[model samples]
Target: MATRARGRGSGRHDGQPGHGRHTTATARPARTRNPLVTAPGTLATPADRALRGKAARTRVPRSAHASWLPSVDRPDPVAVLERQGRDRLPELLPIRYGRMAASPFAFLRGAAAVMAADLAAAPHTGLTVQLCGDAHLLNFGLYASPERALLFDLNDFDETYPGPFEWDVKRLAVSVAVAARENGHPEAKAGRAAQEAVTAYRTAIRRLARLGELDVWYTRIDAEQLLPLARSTRHRRRAESSLGRARRRTSLQAYGKLTEVVDGRRRIIEDPPLIEPAGTSDMAFLRKIFSDYRSTLSEERRLLLDRYRFVDAARKVVGVGSVGLRCFIVLLAGRDADDPLFLQIKEARQSVLEEHLPSGPYVHHGHRVVAGQRLLQAASDIFLGWMTGPQGRAFYWRQLRDMKGSADVAGMSPADLVSYARLCGTALARAHARSGDRIAIAGYLGNADTFDRAVTAFALSYADQTVTDHATLGAAVAAGLISAAPGV
Candidate 1:
């Protein structure tokens, strides 16, 4: 029989891992950097290297972390969101707001900065890992590895950085709660699903911590491994369907869908406000950008890329949070008219987590994103690279769509959601264990429900806060404080 893990089972792990306690005035004040802005490289060495995990686990007791409430100093969530929107494409700003206003879940997806501010204000465990920074339920997806094998892992890293590992957990937990609520499930169901996710993460981390370095590095979750975890035939069918869909989303498919024959040459189709061709001067500049981007690739990849002739470039709006950012898809054609390749060049800003955590060693934001993505994903795109673009904007390059597919969380049944949650949680654990001190994190989690319950409680509370925040955003749009165009 499988041994069930045990712990307090009652107290809340509610706020940040160590938030809400007051210090005595008589005692000397604890000296630390501005908690809101963690300096880079501070966690390079463990506080007590000899028994780091044990020391950390002792510092933040499992049972001691109960329900978490927001601190009085929590920054205004709207102000944070607005700060991110600044300098983004003014025309697309309305569309970004519209997408976020669709649901609380959508709002949560766009509010990483809001959560980052709140998290920075919360109590922390002082333990660090390569955080996904935006580990929401939808961010975990299936993609093709270099060997053409399908694998599941954290797919978004625009916000990746080293920070308190629990920050990722907290973000993921709240997303589960918000998604479950969007699906009309009871709060209890959401809580249960969030708990299952945290439990899976804790359990997987512990298991990985016991493995050798190479074994942990080799760990992966693929379609074959995930199929058996499906709770029902319906769930299995959905999983297979999603996998099939991803496999068919190759460059050839994209070429057919996004390009047109113009005077015997292939050119990107125009779809204003979403996808539009670059102007004459803009095209000339993009050619230079592509040249610079090629230098960042490996010698072999650069040679391979040279075989293809650049055909066209277009601006495209992609994803909820990334809608207003400067994103583009460059089209290229090989010697054979039928051969095609697509590359995505996305703007790389300082990570939302960067403001709250210690900065990384890399100075270029694009390098930072690519490095972090390579660190977390089991395998990354062969075309993965980064470069500084026009006006010194940092940007990363990758295949536009290499068999990528996301979960339809809003449409899942309660039981299916729980299963999917576990898959995501397990995937997250694998990614973190790749670069984190899994032993110490596992020690903190133990073989119990203490951390699980605490995270679930916090997730539930934050989901409520997100809903209220979404309403505030909606009201702002209604009152013309911010322009919005829904369903764009």
Candidate 2:
């Protein structure tokens, strides 16, 4: 266990101070509901107002963040990777390391736990929020809301939980910095991108704090709305191109590419390692899981789901960090062959942040993920729910691919990259404000670029660390110390 120097409390609710030390991972008493989200004008309190003054007066200045990174006895980054692989699929663990070895940015995405360890050692304001524990640049994307409208938000929640809001922002800042480097952008450009993300987060949270609570909760950035934020014609053009492609990426579109007629019926296409049909034992086990999942859904949703009958399922490998985790795609059909539904059943484990933050209130990690998603997202999947499997594994289920899309940062020019960075920052702030005390957080930030610059410096320094860590992983793969199946 590690401990960070507590700068000054935000005068808000008490977050786990000195989180680096060992904490209990067992469940605690359940909370009926989140108290941060309140009716208009009720989100803040008299204490919050006084705390704002206290924070602005005596809290550690943001500039002090420049020296937050501890230079002593840091844990071995390679050892951390090996530790995380312990419970993952042995055959697929190599692919996880291989993808991480692809580039520094890829490594950043796959190494959330590594950064979480570092962040636990850094100085932080004691402001806890339901954090997107792995809030890297790529994780923020466009997805279909319940209304069927495309909206921009944090799309990954595998590690979402209660932790310092700064952790999420720091991860995002480093990701932008690393992405810029991966694209061969100048160091100055990379620094500027990281700074812009911090600035956007600061500005957005301040604005949201001033608004009525409901108004802030209701706010969401739609795909079309983001175009106006682009700073240049090039930025706008690239965003439009990305948005156009996203609009066509519906469940129907995925059905065409991911399925085919097998004799007289349709089934998921097999692409060994990446996508393969389930075995008899797995299929039987999944049937029971599906029944438990249906019980978790609301009556209306269950009725809607009942209209479809289970057809088939397959093991599907997804994402860099989640590569070795157990994930499956289940197919269902309605009255006709054209009527289809795809549900993604992903295994849920304790959040990486749990080791450094407060333990979750939910007994099941699947419930923790679902509850956190609902708390952070402006709107979530109608099918989102969770269930425990016979083997005691927890899982969350959601629509497989309904108009989901992420930006191709590699293709973006430096200018466009900066613009995208700001968008991600804005999304991160919005997500935090939904489940955190916006007024308290805004007060801690003040109206200065002090924190912004400090975080940018941290991001760049951490980006360098990431490069070194990534090289270590690559070396391990080459040395035959670890198996690595490339070209997945």
Candidate 3:
């Protein structure tokens, strides 16, 4: 059983809700006490760790995970979302709501806070890992590693933090269920799809447990390996096409599409509300922070960064859950006019999981995000770094695009979804094995499919809850209680 606590008070800063202003606040130190630490002693051996995991089953039965009745006093999902927007840019909150209202799957992507609260309401196996925090179906994708090898892994970490390993699994399972329903799959098929993800997670963890430390660390799901998993020739061709598209989605490709030469100098093209020119003061602040960000990188990386000259920047809205956060894209030229690089600086707020679990090790939210990404990813962006800006806002920097691609979940056939779900589960288990105790987790899971079946039941139930929650958000928008700019 994991120790639990209600989240502490939120960090608050007041700002006008409109566009074009940098909301500033004094930086405050994060809580230093870490409640997750074990007793100070020699590390437990694999046998001992496995025994400890088995011991946990007596306290929190595997069957306990299947229960998913909404508590009588469950927080209203809409109110929970409104609370998150309190510190966000006011003008953009509607866009977030609009995007979330588009589908139950979209709502699941945006409602990490809601799920965190619900997960906290239950007892856990106490197996801890650096969670992806919001491990919905869409968050898993392909990206180029530092070595330029394409690998599929968890790509989003805005809410990454330390917590019970099952939280991530449950989130992933629920997402699979919700996505299947949205694609017009029946309840039985959705259940099977969700079950496949948990089964893969269980089996993968067990396999990783047998590996040596270095072998576990070196494990990664390369894009080339995915081709063999495709069931038919058509599916194989589709996989190849997707991989080809991802390979083309590099900084050079973005430069061609997102830049236009203005007065003989390259400038980021603006697409109103979605993408717009930064104000003069915002641009100056970005330039100053560029050095602060550079300091966080290694000497070699700094030299690589120094080769590029800053050309232009623009504020850009991105993603469903992240719509209201402060984000900017900076354009830099490496050689002459043809060579280009794009880096994104996005705001990093506290993880939604923070309130449910104990405080994490990082003081700055940006450092927390960067560190979590490095720990959870098999290979991370070479340019990954973090910095503080005016008003002590936390922000992390990374390449704007590096062969990134996500599956089209809504268009997937039932078979395609089940296969994709298993892939995501395998990738997720590999991530957990890197950060958490694989031996103990594999022990707790055991040989039976009990945990898998239980989580599948929970996923189906939660998918129903998500539908209601999604409808509730739509109702709020319909009643004029919340504004939504649909189809943006």
The residue ranges of model 3 lying beyond 4 angstroms of the native Cα positions read 1-41
Candidate 2 per-residue C-alpha lDDT over 283-314 given as tens digits, one digit per residue, 9 for 90 to 100: 99889888789988899999999999998899
Residues 1-488 of candidate 3: C-alpha lDDT, one tens digit per residue: 11111122121112211110121211211134222234565567778778867876875667567767766667999999999999888999999999999989999999999998888766666677889999988999999999999999999999999877899999999999999998999878888899999999999999999999999999999999999989999999999999999999999999999999889878899898999999999999999999999999999999999999999999999999898999999999998778899999999998998876655789999999999999999999999999999999999999999999999999999999999999999999999999888888888999998889888988888888899999999999999999999988
Over 4 Å off in model 1, which ranges?
1-51, 63-66
TM-score (C-alpha) between model 3 and the true structure = 0.92
Clashing residue pairs, candidate 2? Answer: 2-20
Give stretches of model 2 more than 4 Å off: 1-18, 22-47, 50-60, 68-71, 230-237
lDDT of each: 0.80, 0.82, 0.87
Rank by TM-score, descending?
3, 2, 1
Model 1 backbone overlap count: 12
Best by TM-score: 3
lDDT of 3: 0.87
Q: lDDT score of model 1?
A: 0.80
Worst 10 residues of 2 by lDDT: 1-10
lDDT: worst 10-residue window of model 3: 17-26
Q: Give per-residue CA lDDT, model 1, range 1-488, as digits (tens).
A: 11222222332234224232232221211223422233574442332332555555555555444444555566666667788889788899899999999999899999988888766655566667788999999899989998999999999999998877888998998899889988999767888888888888999998988887899999998867888877779878877888899998988899999999899878999998899888887688778878888888889999999999888899999999888888889988887768888999899998887765554768998998899999999999989888887788899999998998888887888898899899888999999998877876776777778788877877877787898889989999999988889999
CA-only RMSD, every prediction = 5.6, 5.0, 7.9
